[model samples]
Target: MKLPIYLDYNATTPVDKQVLDCLLPFFSENFGNAASRSHLYGWTAQEAVETARQQVADLIGAETKEIVFTSGATESNNLIIKGLFESSFPLKRHIITAETEHKAVLDVCKHLEKLGAEVSYLKPDNVGNITLEQVQKATREDTFLITVMFANNEIGTIQPIQAIGAWAKEKNICFHTDATQALGKISVNVNEMNIDALSLSGHKLYAPKGVGALYLKKKSPATHLMAQMDGGKHERGFRSGTLNVAGIVGLGKACELARNSLLFENQKLSVLRDKLEQGILQNVSNTQVNGNPTNRLPNLTNISFGGVDGENLLMSFRDIAVSSGSACTSASVEPSYVLKSIGLSDELAYASIRFSLGKYTTEAEIDFTIKYVREVVEALR
Candidate 1:
């Protein structure tokens, strides 16, 4: 196995070689503003951008016009949540989201709260799954949007988004999902789930950062979100700025590759994830896997060691790269809010480690990680 094994794919993935290859040409030879409509260079750039838009759209079962590129999921989340609230729709003064959602969504909700928007932050069950009943009970006539995450980044708990989406549809309320960590790991069909909007970052898959997309269903209420940024109307006035051509190209290629290989690759990842989880459980004492065991991403696991400091344990394994919380929140010394929201004590929350596998993760790395983690936890105890 390679030294300094990377098991933090949920944080971000290394851009795949093939994705990189597709990105390079857009940076130089085909460099032109996609908005420059009068020249051949612009035409080439526009074609590439449109193709990438379609590639991104296909992954989520959305139309190309539904895809609006952004800086990343944070911007996408902000655009949908804040934009919808700021739009001309009167009486849409409330929003609902889970407490376990990424800070992007959570923070946006907080910001909206200060703007006189009624926000309901639903807590998850012990297994990190929020129930559809909870969402239904929280809904009100003024609740214009219900934003849930497709998967928990730290615990890999997959939410019942399909059910929530259907409920939202029945209620004639818009539903959105932050699918950053879930996109390449599972099938994300907007139609199948009745999803009106979704936020996804390219870096979470095999593409570069600073490029993501928000899927806003055509002719849906979600498509009418007010533009957050001001400039020449780009992305159909939903977001305004020059696009990142190279990153978009990379994101498109990554999506295409993931669509082609996700089924076969996710199965392999699940086997590796299970081996690692099981090995640690059997060999190490005072250890528990966080989140629902069966209803999670195939390539992710969050484990908590009862008697060890997660930070010290992480420090002990210099040869392994992992995280104790979401990458955006890792620098904070406090226990993970997501874990705490699911009923874990501060001690257990602080003791947790998030290990996310990816397309490039191998059996050798999983075996090595299992043994290494077991030894460290035992030694620390």
Candidate 2:
């Protein structure tokens, strides 16, 4: 049997070989507790960690001291939302975020709402893109923070972060964007955009998992956030516990490579994405694309095929690495919230599949998948 094709980049990504090379020394030869100050090994590890911090900062246009290493985007999101609220900053207690954010943000907001803090969830228009006007209307004089994701993982819709950030800046509200899906695939200049805080994951950008960075805008008054954990004084006491030296270094290298190669990679993936979308739509009947066409990430396509069950269609393409909303969330047996938000019915939402491309996706693979999908979709009908 041929090797299975992988297109579910939105879920996760494999580590790059270059990043792996940079991480190896930390696991064996140079292994030391970064927090231990008494020994040469410890100091060496600390230096390595700091150098990695610089690389991460360079990738996202932030200060070396502003990058806080954490477990992943989920942890970073928690730290940002909870820590900001808990900080001594003289701002309002209200938080504004979109309804389509990952469970990480949604759950945290729900938890905060339980604690008496008012939270406003702004739902985007049919294409899953939020408007600056909607944000302006939802925000209050007491609104302290506005957190929006740079891109949607399921539909690959890129948000108007710059406009939102500008509006938030004018209102003196702290703006945070979760760029986990956007960081590796797109260019994110936090300074030019006036983003107050941002989160990025390593694995999503071809580095190993277990490490991510939270970008804190320097001198933003929101820079000093409350630490979620308590232990050794690491990450300026904003995040406690000994640093993951190997993972951090890998993440830094990955960020550097991603920033350097973003444009070329996006251009390559755009062709494949177009082929996948156009082929499926032309070959199969009763299909529709989701999200803003030209304003989306270069490597993702979410298509809803009517009449056939998404799960059954997924089963037919057993060898391909595509995903159905039904398959990814099969444990729930419910329609996709993302699709429903964009005006798809329960059946259409259930029939949606997200095919996300990546750095290694090839023309032959796309051609084969398109052909296979056409055959399988027709057979299922």
Across residues 1-381, which tens digit of lDDT does each residue of candidate 2 receive?
255899989888988989899989999989998988999889988988988898899888888988999999999999999888877334567899998898889899899888767888988888999999989999988888899999998888899899999999999888999999998788889999889999888889888888998888888846767888988768888898889999998998898888889889988989889999999999888999998887898999999888998668777778688777653454667777777777889888878889999998889889998888888888899
Query: Per-residue lDDT of 232-259 in model 1, one digit per residue for the tens?
Result: 8998888889889999999999999999
Error of 1 at 112 (Å): 0.9
Error of 1 at 357 (Å): 0.4
Predicted structure 1, TM vs. truth = 0.97
Q: Model 1: runs farther than 4 Å from truth?
A: 88-90, 326-332
- Worst 10 contiguous positions by lDDT, candidate 1: 325-334
* TM-scores, all models, native as reference: 0.97, 0.96
Query: Which candidate has the highest lDDT of all?
Result: 1
Q: For each candidate, what is the lDDT?
A: 0.90, 0.87
Q: Can you tell me which runs of candidate 2 are displaced by over 4 Å?
A: 88-91, 327-331
- Give residue 72's error in model 1 in angstroms: 0.8
CA displacement after TM-score superposition, residue 131 of candidate 1 (Å): 1.2
